[model samples]
Target: MINNMNKFIAIVGSNSNKSTNRELLKYMKHHFQSQAEIELVEIKGLPIFKKSADKFVPQEAKDIAKKIEASDGVIIATPEYDHSIPAILSSALAWLSYGIHPLLDKPVMITGASYGSLGSSRAQSQLRQILDSPELKARIMPSSEFLLGHSLQAFDDNGDLKDKVAAQQLDGLFKDFLQFVNIFNQLNNAKEINVQKAKDFSWDKD
Candidate 1:
């Protein structure tokens, strides 16, 4: 059985301001806090990504990578801009691609909200394509796709998620994500152990 006694989860939102996306993330955080150690990673402080700065990525980006690497799973809540994920989110993903690739073989889930009628469905769909690339090394959950419509009205002025149905759905998503992470961690640990054993059992060994 997989032991999730110390699993760490990271939550990221695209917008830098008081965004509904952040509220969704916070809601997930609250849901998982009792079951796992949670860390909130804000992408707002990250500088715009540039390929020329590869050798020395900004500290904010570097910090985000480390957190992703250390966590067992990642949850992203993105906001739709013009029917697509925000450029800031894309930039952050681009920056992450150059590093050690902490997302490889990890469990990830994406959700979003929009002020328009369609919610962030288009943006979430586009994000799934970007995340599906081989470089990400993550398993995307297919059971549910969360897209909040009229997001500005869904949440209160304090940025709290006021919709009970959305809150419950977010809770369910985190629970499933935790289960996925536990299984993934178990397999990863087993592989590490086998690799170590193989290294120690070389034919040249006594």
Candidate 2:
């Protein structure tokens, strides 16, 4: 019984204009076009990541973090580069971990598209591990992995998944994900701790 209407921000973790990952994200947007409000976001505007404490985090980066904080769910569509996640997505996670944790306990889904047979499975696996690290904590649904392999042939000019079998399976995955969102939301609220406990256990990195 999934009744909650969640606002999800879809982020294609690549900066290239003609990215296959972006196309995949577009297909996902169309897949659930009427079910939820899906907004495609980019990370090109974010300033370069700083490692030192003296320098300040970019305002644009902060705003993006805030946006993710406010959203009910997140979708990260990444391309596998060198058998791992790209720097763009990883950099964004580092900043989001700082200045308060917006990604903390939020429901997220990771998908990837690639020209290779594995799709972005390697990148997604790495990303899932990163999500659980102290740098960030996002509640990732353990559902079907939407790997759009051979992306060039898998999608059409309009970005709709052309493969009927893959499309049907992904459609089912989305329905389950929406339900996962509701359950995850409940757990986040129900497990919220007292102020002292929150401060003691919270990985705000403050």
| The best candidate in terms of lDDT | 2
In angstroms, give how far residue 1 of model 1 lies from its true place.
19
Q: lDDT value for candidate 1?
A: 0.71
Cα lDDT tens digits, model 2, 1-206, are 12455789888798788898888878778778778777888986775566665436778777877788778899999899999988888887776765446777788888888889999898999999998765466788895588889987887777788899988988888888889998876676633442224335534246
lDDT of all predictions, in order shown? Answer: 0.71, 0.79
True-structure lDDT of candidate 2: 0.79
Q: Tell me how many residue pairs clash in candidate 2.
A: 0
Pick out the ten consecutive residues of candidate 1 with the lowest summed lDDT: 195-204
Q: Quick one: best TM-score, which candidate?
A: 2
